[model samples]
Target: MFSFAISKSERNALFHRRETMATRMFLNGGVYSMADSGRLDARVEGLTIDPVDGRVLAVGPQCGPVAASDVLQLPAGAVIVPGLHDRHTHWLFALFANAVVLGGVKTLAEAAARIEAQLAEQATGWVVATGWNTGLLPAGLLTQSWLDSIVKGRKAIIFDQSFHGALISSTLAKEIVSKFPREAIGSYHDGVIHEQYVMLAMAWMELDDWTLKAALLQRQIIMGRVGFTRITDMGVMGFPLLHALQDIYRRGLMILPCDFAVQPWMLREDPLLSATSASVLHFQLRWLKEFADGAFGNRLACMCGHHRYSDGQGGKLLLDERRYVDDVLLARERGIDQFAIHCIGCAACEAASTAFGTVMQRLNGESSGCTFSFEHFETVHPKLIEHVARLQRAHVRIEVCSQPGFLSDLTDYTDRLAAHVMARINPYGDFRKEGLAWRAGTDGAITGDDPWGGMALAVNRGGEQTITVPEIMGTFIDAPLAVNGPATFLILDRDPFAHLEQLGQVQVLETWIEGRMVFHRRN
Candidate 1:
């Protein structure tokens, strides 16, 4: 069912042709051309590509003639679809794929054992680990003593699955408390790190550029293997990371096209913009990232009502209203086209909407070229939805970038917080009814970053607010392939439409970017 038509010699020949040939023809596949209306057009049998420029030159049965050497015939039953895009994801952090992953550990003891093993393997430095859920622990909390027992007073930080906070060893806490300002250290409770502390601790143990570049390349290959051709990095660190990505692109090592949203703090602290024309392959610095609140899983999301497990208290707001408004205005004035604000709770969503309103009113509603997005618009209160609809009616381009996989990830938690939170998490149907422009993201290493898993979650929604396959697919592949468009696409082993329920199980035979085969399944 999953096979490559090109043998080893043929694959080598094709790679050689990629450098020498001006044009290439990909034939014998079900090519789903994207329509202007954002729907898949009828499948074509062939596509002619200009390999040098990485664009689709022609399509349909009557594609112009090409030499036999230029034709790369696909295997039987191959299905070619337009490239996929994740509108919001942390690209740099996703590189932590190599870090000690502990997503499905059942107990704190299990987590400790895993951390102990990783610490044993590493010779020196902090032993960082991630993806431990307190809910899974018997004590229902990650205490410093527990981490200290395993880390043996060594510097370590174990991030929760939500990534809103972490569990730090006492050795790391003492170092932070001594060196950093009390405010910068944020909250350290029972061994858990919160807010600015998480950022500061990560900065302290930041990976070297060489290690980061290697991890980034691994992440890109993983993305291509999962059918992502373009991604919008929701919160990219400025300067060093930006420069590193530029170098990666210049060396022709970058696999996918990336658009970055610089952290708002970086915009203020560094205040430098790289030349966009330096290299077309370079990652584009696009938007400013502003966090309105934290995440729901960690009880840090700024909610209007009480958290079910907590002492009837709402979540925390991370931003000052006046500063948030001023920052948006400043970014717009500085020529940024978009501002992405992370708002997971109703209170945070309302606050961000209000800020957008204030800034738009000040600009006399002249926000045609600029847009604002509420990342993880998770909770849907009637008031928040109504307010967002009103803002949309007022010509404010307020889009939402939601992670449907959160539904699959938070199903049990949602049940526990049922009385306190909205019944439906990520109300895609409600968003559609309200005529809100929205896109889906995986949030990466934080959640499982598989797009097919995301698509499955969007369609099923665990029987709460389901959407049709096409509607869900739109969020993954928003645009259709066209002439002069970036040559990016996925070759699937089975037709997705015919195997809707098994979408996540569908194998990606190959992924092409800019007319070159970036990934191929090793049969």
Candidate 2:
């Protein structure tokens, strides 16, 4: 094989000068800098062709002709690849959002107990706690009495994990009555307030957007250290996006890569898109996030059949077909054509597919290459699978973001679900076998954001499938062009054997954006 080499001039020029060393220490009376203290770009001697971008870049070759600029040279044994992109994440909740989350508390008694303790702290005028799943909770109801007892005298409102519902105390209810018309608070009982009433109350309540962003940023930095380069902030909370952009500008820092899609209804009502600039846009797309149905775990997931527990019916559709169709059409007209729908059940998936097809037909194929993606394709039937495959054939990328962590929480529920239907849901292993691309999502509020776990869940077949390191990297590979994808070839540039020795689940050595280094192991 021909040896890859770099010119000597680049090496000397890239070496650090004395002053800017990250670490400099004297050993045996000689001072050696811990890092390339001066140069912005280190000179790498062993040039390897980058498979994805097709550039000759430096990588370390252990126990061989070593090059100083190669980033891998600093880490005793490691491999380098293009950055990892999450494609799906909800950073609005932050890390603490999932911790001590009172969302799943069963029974009004349990919820009341937790809230009563929280009320004692008297943190804020209106205490807000999230992470409640209605499907698993006892009685599966949010009543006024429950809210009042838990909140005591303080105004309180806790959002369901889905973000589609809210449980508010009587204090907040009184405030709601004062602000809106009597009709606005319709169907109001001491126990439950349904429909748009919750949202109306939240909108009226003053929320500190900046503080939420600050809280989210503090958590994002920790994610970066764990090797995450890009994350999708897939919710209506504009705080993370706003704060991330501001941070990048102020300090010339790049920690967490982000992509955000706003709610379509909000676009029509608030028009926040007009104020956003193109360069600052994450993922270079403005996807409209619409909900077709609720989540299965929460019993909010819409279904054609009856819900497992409820005799009346399954969950309701969060967005009516008319609303879904109108939003897609308006999103295209507004130049935000990318649509990301949250659909966990088959019924919901069909609605999303229908809406997307309708929008595409209406646009006469003038969508500027906009793609529609299904967020959590958790429960898909064979007919639906064929439908999605057909869409992909038509150049629409049908994507799936599954919460691997949910397997533990949902296994028993899934097994107890209709036997015929169980095969249709969370069948990622089958999807992979069919040559379909499966994108892993943290689904943050419900699952832990561990990419490795998601990767393992994607490839292995037995019990959700166990994934090898090579398989994990393949998820982001540009299929059709390369067998194992671009990153595979990139890995080949280094000492392949040694690199393999140091690989771990979800552990990344370096991160690059647009072919530039943004995060590297701090030797």
Candidate 3:
């Protein structure tokens, strides 16, 4: 539950305190606090329609009109909309290794130059660097010999741009391999581990809890200042980590609003554990993410034509149908509401759809209430789009991780690598026409967190579909208020990115979540 303090009036007192907890406030004058009760009330402007109670309350001019309230007026020119719901973000991983950015380095020498600088600045015994794309590297693939020479004797690890693969020094690799079982050791090929193997290997390294905590808090605050009121933390691995973060925010050290989407493995370990609570109030914990295939950069996404590009060798499937079905059924049995399957390629999407349909039948009605979401529909086939539409009609949601940066980030000399040819068949407009609740997200860290970037990429046609920015944002604006907002909300046509301009020119504008002013754009 979320609580807040407000300026109120009592018995002629100008700024009296309302200590008693209250649920709803319809005050005719002054301010009030509901932090103790964990309820919040805020008035948002710049709306085309009134979105008060999950319904379109009003549209046209009436929607944007000021409501009758005794709370302090927010002053004019401050455009407000419903807080952003970033459905996909690698928040933890990004902050953990953000300063060690390694994008845009062309050659091994350039990469070494950057790593050498990072090592000098880093105070820790262990140094980790991320965000180097092997596909875009000037010298092609980064061999272990190349990484060894750069770090010399330091315990260093360089993660590929995909974050799924890494080039580790032999010293660090040897240190990590000791904790894992025998079978997992095969990931090391000349001390370079790719995909899940890299994550497992890095987990073995020592991490200072105190230092990590401070860094995350500082990063979260910075994001909040950037107008991010709500973020979905997909990086949280377990209940403890989620609990720790929640506690930090409850102490009023909030930088941004957040909703945690725990990984599937965490839910499997503790089925009854509810990561949701009063202090960590506004949360959606039902999403269980599973990877059907790895990333495209690594050529590990399960696809029918993966072999065509990689020496006539197809990609590997990360999650088999049996494991997929088991996880889906388990979430269903526990009354969990959703599962987001990271399916990128056509084959993976079809495989995931089948697993969901199978689980739907197995769970009967009690467990079928949970929705299934297919994340990153990058290389989807035309025929599969029809099946996906059917799933949406049956309450399934699709999250298209549209990042235009990928075009520049993963260019393969020609525009026909994996999804280049199939781009025309992505069918984004088709899904919209079919009336599916489609949402866009930047896999953040991997792609920058500019919502406009995702919008521009998705709209500026490829394959067979061409959508405009107005059309995409139009659908996006309506879906969240319809599906996630409180009783009576508002949808604004004003672009959030553009609204930042109003800050210095006019008032010291801000936005409040559950009544707490979490963001105040400075002049």
Candidate 4:
């Protein structure tokens, strides 16, 4: 196989540089050094990088260089910025992209036909499909009978676009119902599965270690090309995934640095405290993830009021409030300093805030440098925002990890929401004004993990709440580019601020991680 390798001169120059040496120069580019003052200092035209370890050596208009091969000169019109960070995503889902995708199918008939075709091609134990949008399908359209007609006694599981719900063939449904109880399965007749049952059914369709490792490696490469040097895998399962990641890193196949937030249930089951001590470079077990409610699109988000088109009743909560508080306290006691709670609605947000407030009060406002995050704070009601502000006033150190891509992905559904509810969606400017620390994420593979695409959605979704380019960039790149920081950044084909509306279309010309070029656009 043909391989792309750096020239001999380049390799020699890079290897010969001392740890304290400034031997590499990146010149003639609009360099965005994300300084601590929240200012966009883009006037710099050059940067000195320590070739030995890939850290920024100095930032200015000019830098000392030893050899031409050691210097990377930017092309005309190209701009360099800090590498993007996705605050929340399911790494497993991204790895499972090989599963039959049904993202754009408009109706139930289209979904069924696609599933039928997929199953016909595979002689399988169980067929798994994903990305069905129940919002587009008519009520009562996806039932056990409907799935049975397609699967024809074969076992199959089809997940909704939100991944919160699922439709299974009668064969699989009967098997699940028999193992558990009919009522425990949520709704056998409608073929709808939710909560823990979704995890249970998915566990049955297991992939071997090699398959998972390949999938993860492929996904990481794709993310690198899109300009992500680091990501936070929101809720990873157990040791298998971690073991796979360790194996990949050992084989020198790792691309991006990942921090895993183990699910609360998994932490409770094993508490894998030793896993944190395990020297898995590029991997950190950062947070304990808990779900407060379902997603907004499925009308299952724990809301203060009924969904506009639905049964005129608010959604249900996935985790009890008291239990959530207990979980937070327990996680802290176990030395897990951070928590990422999924809250997409007013009620869920309020519940999370209350739980966080209780934990803070008990700890006497000391978190030991730990942070609490409300993931997917999608529906930003003014009252909920106020509630959060009050918590911040008490030194709660709460952060909101939101998905700006929701504007682009769920446009139609959000448009049809109650006028009052729709008005509060993604209150980015409001969060900023209220002095709330916030960041943006893609929540892939539900949405495209394109950081620039997400930035465009945040920009074009016109409201006083819309975020500025600098502000959006701040969400991805938290700290300044300095000598000690990771040598991770991207070179874009065009300045993102210069082409705000076309941000999504702007190509990533080059991606660098730890001072090594991981991806370069082919001429």
Report every candidate's CA lDDT. 0.67, 0.50, 0.50, 0.68
Provide TM-scores for the models.
0.86, 0.70, 0.72, 0.86
| lDDT tens digits by residue: candidate 1, 117-165 | 8988876777878766555553244578877887887888877666657
lDDT of 4 by residue, 45-159 (tens): 7777765677777766555654765566788888888888888876777435556777767677787778878887877667778876655664366677887888899888878
Q: Which portions of model 3 miss their true places by more than 4 Å?
A: 1-78, 94-98, 138-141, 178-186, 201-205, 238-243, 250-252, 255-257, 267-279, 294-316, 329-335, 395-422, 425-427, 460-464, 475-509
Q: Tens-digit lDDT track for model 2 on 1-523?
A: 2222334443223221122121111101111111232321232222232423533332332223323433233243333444455666765555233223675576766776777776776566567767666556632466666667656777777665545456677777777755544433123434344434554554454434444444555455545444455676565344334444444434333334466677654566555453244225333336778766543233425221112333332333455656676777776666775788777767767767787777667668575477778877776776777667666766675565655545544443553466556545567555655556666666665556655555444444345434444444544422211112222112112322234443325354444443333333442
TM-score of 4: 0.86
lDDT of 2 at 427: 72
lDDT of 3 by residue, 48-83 (tens): 222222233322123333444412333332334444
Any idea what lDDT model 2 has? 0.50
Compute the lDDT of residue 114 as modeled in candidate 3: 81
Task: Itemize residue pairs with steric clashes in candidate 4.
Answer: none
Cα lDDT, model 1, residue 421: 66
